[model samples]
Target: MRNLEFKEKMHEYSIWRANLVQAIEMYQQWLTRYGMDDAHRTNTLLNILSSLKNDRITLAFVAEFSRGKTELINAMFFAESGVRLLPSSPGRTTMSPTEIFYDAEGGSYIRLLNIESRLEDMSLAEFKNIPERWTQLELNCDSPTQMQNAFKELIATKKVDRELADRLGLWNEREAATQGVMNPDTVEIPCWRHALISFPHPLLKEGLSIIDTPGLNALGTEPELTLNMLPSAQAIIFLLAADTGVTKSDLEIWMNHINRARSAKKQGLAVVMNKIDAMWDDLGGSNDYDRSIKSQIKASATILKIDEESIFPVSAKQALLAKIKSDKELLAKSRISALENYLSNDILRDKRNIMASIVMRDIGSLINESVNTANTALSHASEQLEEFRKVDFHNQDMTGKLMAETRDRQSLYMANVENFQSSRRVFIVQAKMLINSLAEERINEVIYAAKHDISKSLTTIGMKQNIRKLFDDLRDLLQDSVDITNETRRLVKAIHKKFKDEYGFKEIEPILFDIKKYQLELEEVFEEGEAFRTSAKVTMTEQGIVVDKLYSTLVAKAKVILGRAHDDAISWSNGALSPLARQIKDHKKQIEGRLQMLRKINESKGTVAENIAHLEAELVPLKRQREELAIMIKSMQLEGQLAESS
Candidate 1:
């Protein structure tokens, strides 16, 4: 278990997740066993299971070129391979945004999207679904040399004429000017826009994925890396060379992408002062070396406006060599174990908590509902049994009275159903309005018009104005969606109150559909867009590149948010009135069964003892299910406490 903290934690995380999935499966079976499963609940549980099964703990590594970012990844996850699994040589190794994870369905391979794919109007997400366009390469996992050689393709570059390079957004005019190149016939561009590697590594198999982003140029070129990919990651490791501390480009990246809002701390963001081995001086003695390291940490903390503890000074090169050779002393000197500890305890734990919350929110509530239903059924069954024992089978008057009461309750149930149907009809019309307000087509229309305005505009100011207008329109649309949702909620409340007050249906509060979340997300995008619109880089970069980047990153991200909002609206529309309806239906069933039993007894066709026996039999499984549900809730509640104690 030497140098294996992160690996062990990941293994534990995977097992815990599997247990949660199993609990959901058991609940699904219980729902079916009790005849409580419906199409809506069934679909929701399936979606929850699918999400948990495919969950990944993603950590994105962001750094400028030659900061040993790739090497740090190698030392952390791939050191066990006894080689640098990802090519981490001196040059800009990760020219494209590369994602590495285990492929559950396929063999080890690298899927590279051609740089020319950027010319298409489609976003990177749209391109991912059409896999045929990516060039795929198989990796021989058994051969380290072969894998290393194959991975070099990530850094592969091709010489393209200046026109083509400019067209691809690779040729930076200011950079060219600084290098004193007046006119060059040709320039180099990365061969791929993105790389996806599916390797059968242990941690990856346990659902750990890594995103290694290239230098500033790559970040500037690809808006998806900032908008969709990095934001989605649970953690981000921003790398800096210990010798150079935060360089000018590093500051630019931090301000624009990494720590723009300084809220990255909440997302397991950490700064790695890599290549600290350079500061390991033999003549300086341990005390002097410690002071120098401490001073550098302080300086970096001040410059980055981050806590001192957030930065980890590590020698990734030494760590890799130390782990491969099993040199404990070298490993200790590298301070790699501290970073490993952070990953195992801080970052991974936070991710685990987030996923746990999702499971509880979705499955936990359903389990609670089922348990309550089971309890109610058992209680009713017990009452029936007790009353059956006390009933005089020979007395016609007693049986007749019970039969009349049952019929009266049955009448109430029928009236409740009719009223619900009417209310649902009205709600259905309102739900359509809510859904249409958040429709993809609606947002897409605005995006299309805004994109047109930006494309046709000749000035940067015009483009900025158009982009700002797009956000304003989106905000207005989202506000309309929220208003519609509130109206729908109010309607649902009135319906629930009618049933509860008139028909004696149990009070069930409705869940609010969250259009506000999307509104907040759109606001974040608006802020980021505003920052980009005002930044010097926007003016310096080519107009075409800026337009494409904005669409690919910010606009694309907004579209995704709107799409999800619409989907949520649909789900809410379907499930809103279902709880009250189910309650009414179950109540009717109870009454009808009681009525049938009383009629049988009054006719002398069935005995009171026989009815009691049937009720007792029905109560057994209900009690067992209640106990099982209690166990699941307890386990979920104790997860974090147990992990922390361990």
Candidate 2:
């Protein structure tokens, strides 16, 4: 797996981020010197800087047990270890969700939260915030033996009392019977609820995080994984065995977690058909290996109802063995290179563009505001200075005329500022109302209610009808979001018209408000939801798998689907009004500039000239700063375009 492109892209983002921070810092200092410190604006800039500093691209691996998922990760990322770094034997090794990344500030350590912590009813995120709640083990990267020993903690299991197991929902008599662990007095569970491993891998050090999640049972119990981590991930790799194809349990995981949690727009989803080495080749040169792999890929794609191209046939074991032995021929046959190319070219490229869009949206707006403020202040100061120099003390009549005209002109300017103020207020109230209608809390409530209604409706009969109604309700909610976005766009156009035509406000552009893209995504999800319900009916007819299991899977999958919808809705609504928000801020700054002009005009006659001269002198540096910022923004955009093309 080559990460040359990924590394270069990240480096570019780092440079752009640093430059933006420098600009913001300089602007903040300039504001402080001018006695115009705005805490809200400073905090906003600081928050952006913080986000840039902590940005990470997450690649999440998910699958049913024994699909060689960890083997693939070790091959693609840990080839330098010269052996398998993660346990990937025949049975379940990763019993809980494990995250691997380099914690540059915290140094190397393995942090584990005890399984008993789950009983406390606190989330994994909350548990993480309190370091005292975790067990931390320092890691030594210099010693391979120590690193291997430390990693064994990921596989550690403990015997739990039957009563505790039952309370923790780990003991299901019927499921245990199916697994052939019948009539157990005690159950074995992972000692840790989750694991965080920090090491000095090249990718990890470069802000790449990998999440290794266990099978269905583990995911079914972790609400934080389903609700937070998975959805926030940039990409999700669903691993399946090529020999067995998509089993009932694999379908459960896919429907319940992988497909439902991934964003529809980003669509950062891939299927790795692992264990391709198991497909036997015919002795008579019939090309059976390729044909068998192709057949399995087609079957799995149809079963999952996803694009055929997204399914990759790979031999994880062969890939790892080939890498360790430095066998180039075997490595080529492993097909891991194709998957790596997909990640570097598709996933990382998309991430770069997304990061660029955000940087342009926030940092670009900031720089633009600084330029507008500086220009307004500079222009006012220059005009006042020129007028002051024109004042003739030798001629009292000329001075009187000049003073009267300046007062009249100031009155007109003040009236324009007042109108701008009132319009800005109107715009703010309208924007707030529009934004609140699509609030995250409100959308989450709608999703939860739909999930609740659908889950309650999933019985043996009339299940289809109830599920359809639930989808209809969701469709209506999505339409409501669309309506809100459209209304906001309309109101923004009105505001722009009033400011540009009535008040001569410069640089007014209509905000881009399009929830139609997100609406379509929701529509696609609705279709998928319908397919899920239909698939459940089909599963009910299949032997060995019970209807209750199908129903439970449907409920879990529906909840995740609804949750992703809420996330997209909130993101769309918030992003839709960002431009308008910037414009509103610009209007506020313009008003402040006018007020400053009025104050200067009302100052003592002697100091007004000095103040104007000082303000004029400040303009040269401010203009230079604005010019430099504009060049930096253009360069960043160009680099983003190049990265996208590459």
Candidate 3:
């Protein structure tokens, strides 16, 4: 069974996700009905839902050997099995950085990467590409005893000659001297480089992933863990033994890896002083135990340079025993709830905020803009419909006056057509000029510059920093493409101003050919490029492949991107002018028909009722469209409000 607190958190999260899904569906329907193109926004929403479907919140545990990190995991998530579900014996068990999560598609199994495979000069990521290189073993998760026995592989070690150990970066001469083994012939090393375990557990099934990492030595060997996985996790729980607080290796792990990974975002770090039960007192006063624990917490906080409140003192063994035996007093004494509360309240709340921000920024803005645009058009249509209804068709003087106005309208209509032609020619010239400025040649210039920068970086020792600088240059160049966008925008405004001020066309909205869409896409591409370059475990040969792949893909896509921009510029220029020109012609035709009707009524020669009826019939659908549009706008507005409140 899951803890009550986590179950509550899951319930709230599910509700939030369900509401977001509903809003997305409603927006999609609105777009389809209105014939609006929202391919980018719709795709973004789908990706969000897909991520939510696999919504895993990872909590990583980092500690040196036997700091009770494994025991904490067993106590918090696996105590229901009535045994330490993972190997948490007295000696070291977690040799490699182990990731445990429920993989419904992968089945119940353990996958291990052999240490000898490192001799291939391949990174872990490259090793993953060749699945035949790994050792796979099936596990019977249904049997606790079987799982216990299977997990003993974590503690399995091998004896290697001192020279082989040193070559593998496993031997420490100073440590050997301290242990009085200065002339040792052999050294111990972990058998595997990494371990992956997949099983069905309540918390794991609920999208909870746990990363159990070994001490500083193992972390030093795997750069990806420090660079990628640890930073990506929602929370990193660094465990320390209360009996032996702040060891040299613990301080090294904190200062180098864990702290560095979360330097940019400090929300993920948490320290746990585990095995507090080891400080129990029988002969001393009750206050002595409290004072001792407080001293340890203070000492740890001072050493770690972290807030005192961030340290949580807990007894995992007592917590596990208390929960299994239903001992509430012992559970309270264990102080496990303090850490669980932080996870449930603070960490999970931050995750929810992040998810909510994505919804607001992407989907919420999309819905708001669409609804506002529809409302504006509907208002214009309603006002025009009212003006049409007021046209009399019976008054003789009014008919004569309207006939004169129709003739005048014809002249105005010709002027509008001429203005449209003149404006379109000017706008098209400017748009094509802007498009030419943002042409493939310009893009290639930037691409070549980036290529040159990246080439220089490839030979640098600080590969990660160089990769970042490469992407920084790429982002700056991509942003330069927006200059063309700014020019095009100014031209569009000038064209819209001509139509509105000269012809009094207030119903038309600005033609929006958004260059930011392309800008955002490029941003995503660069972010992924950075991730692959900096964190991916690619060998030198694979690094060359990565660079070539990026160059080819980016250059090819750049052509298509600029080509689409050119096409959209031309299309928008044409489309924006055509509507107002059509409206002018239609108004002229309506006036001409009214003039003909008035002539008949004034001469008292024919019935004008049929003409009036025809005009009225045309308005019926316009009114209906306005009504439907109003309903959709209201619904979308309500959705936005609800999302904000959520």
Which one wins on lDDT? Answer: 1
lDDT per residue, candidate 3, 1-646, as tens digits? 2356775785676566666566566556656675553455556557666766777789999999889899899888888888888888888778888999989988888889987654444566566677688788889978988988888887779988887776555677777889888878888888988888889886677678999998888876565577557877999999999999999999989987888667646696789999999999898766999999999999999999888999999999899888888888989989999888888888888887777665565455455545444554455445544554576656666666767876887788788878777877876776676666566676667667766666656453454555566567556655665676677677777777777887776545554567787676556456545555654333333444445545444334444556666665555544545445545655565556556645654665445556455545655654554566446435433445534533
Looking at candidate 1, the ten consecutive residues that score lowest on lDDT are 637-646
Assess candidate 3 and give its lDDT: 0.71
Tens digits of lDDT, candidate 2, 1-646:
5434455655655565566566556656655765444554565567667876788889999998898888888888787687677787788888779999999888889999888876564557668799888799998888766887888888899998887886565666778878888777889988888999998777787678999998887887674576567878989999999999999999999887776687454378889999988886657243878888889999999999888899988988988888788888888889887788788778877877787667665445444555566566567556655765665434557655655665665565667656656756765665566556556566667656655564565454455566676677757766776676677678767766776676565654553555565566556556656765576434443221222333334334444544554554444344443444444455555455545554554553755457567657756765665565456545445445423432
Off by over 4 Å in 3: 119-133, 160-168, 181-186, 393-646
Q: How well does candidate 2 score on lDDT at residue 398? A: 60
Q: Residue 279 in candidate 2 has what lDDT?
A: 86
Off by over 4 Å in 2: 1-37, 263-266, 280-286, 373-403, 416-503, 507-623, 638-646
The lDDT of model 2 is 0.69
Considering every candidate listed, which one attains the maximal TM-score?
1
Listed in order, each prediction's TM-score against the native is 0.95, 0.72, 0.69
List residue ranges in candidate 1 displaced over 4 A.
261-265, 604-611, 631-646
RMSD of 1: 2.8
